[model samples]
Target: MAKKKSDGVNKSQAIRDYYAANPKAKPMEVAEAMKAQGINVTAQFVSTVKSNSKKSKTTRGRASAKKSVAKKPAKRATRASKATSEVSLDSLLNAKKLVEEMGGVEGARNALSVLEQLMD
Candidate 1:
């Protein structure tokens, strides 16, 4: 007699098949469906599997893949862009390092001003 295969063995592929049958099904819905059929799985686990599948199918490296993401079409600008008021601690430290590299903040500003003048 052949040994029985464990339900967990193909759980991710099962989830994908379920998604194909019900295009609108969420990860939680997939988990619930599997539970109804006596297969135990959590929604989070299903989500992780689905995400991993997507990441695996991407042919491009991370940087190019990120850049290729589709953006919404431009809309009319009704308001001026707001300046960022808060700086992250990490960003502040990075900026401090950059300033040191350029001698000081004044030196950095001078370099930026030179760049701006060149752009004009």
Candidate 2:
């Protein structure tokens, strides 16, 4: 098993070295290149690191210009909604009974929790 390398390489170096010998290449392509050269890296990791660096700059560019934005408050569910959400005792009992029939105690407990949350 290979020990993981340091994540200390800045995005500039990573991205530059990645596409230096393989320009116009994608992140997955870069990851494969890293693997070929024996650098422990994943495609997702490459994409994430590259995007993370760009994200700050991208956010800054948008910050200078105003955009229509509103934070919508979460609404409390109505009594009717709550009534409909009530967990049926019969359903829970049936789930428990089925789990017991299948010799699945753990499954019964999991199902019971779902039922309990609904009941609350």
Compute each candidate's TM-score over C-alphas: 0.40, 0.34
Query: lDDT tens string, model 2, 1-120?
Result: 997656665544666666666667888888887777666677788877676655656357425322344534434333334547675665566555567544587876787789899999
Ten-residue region with minimum lDDT total, candidate 2: 62-71
Best by lDDT: 1
In TM-score terms, candidate 2 sits at 0.34
- Residue runs of model 2 more than 4 Å from their true location after superposition: 1-12, 20-23, 57-120
lDDT of each: 0.74, 0.64
Clashing pairs in 2: none
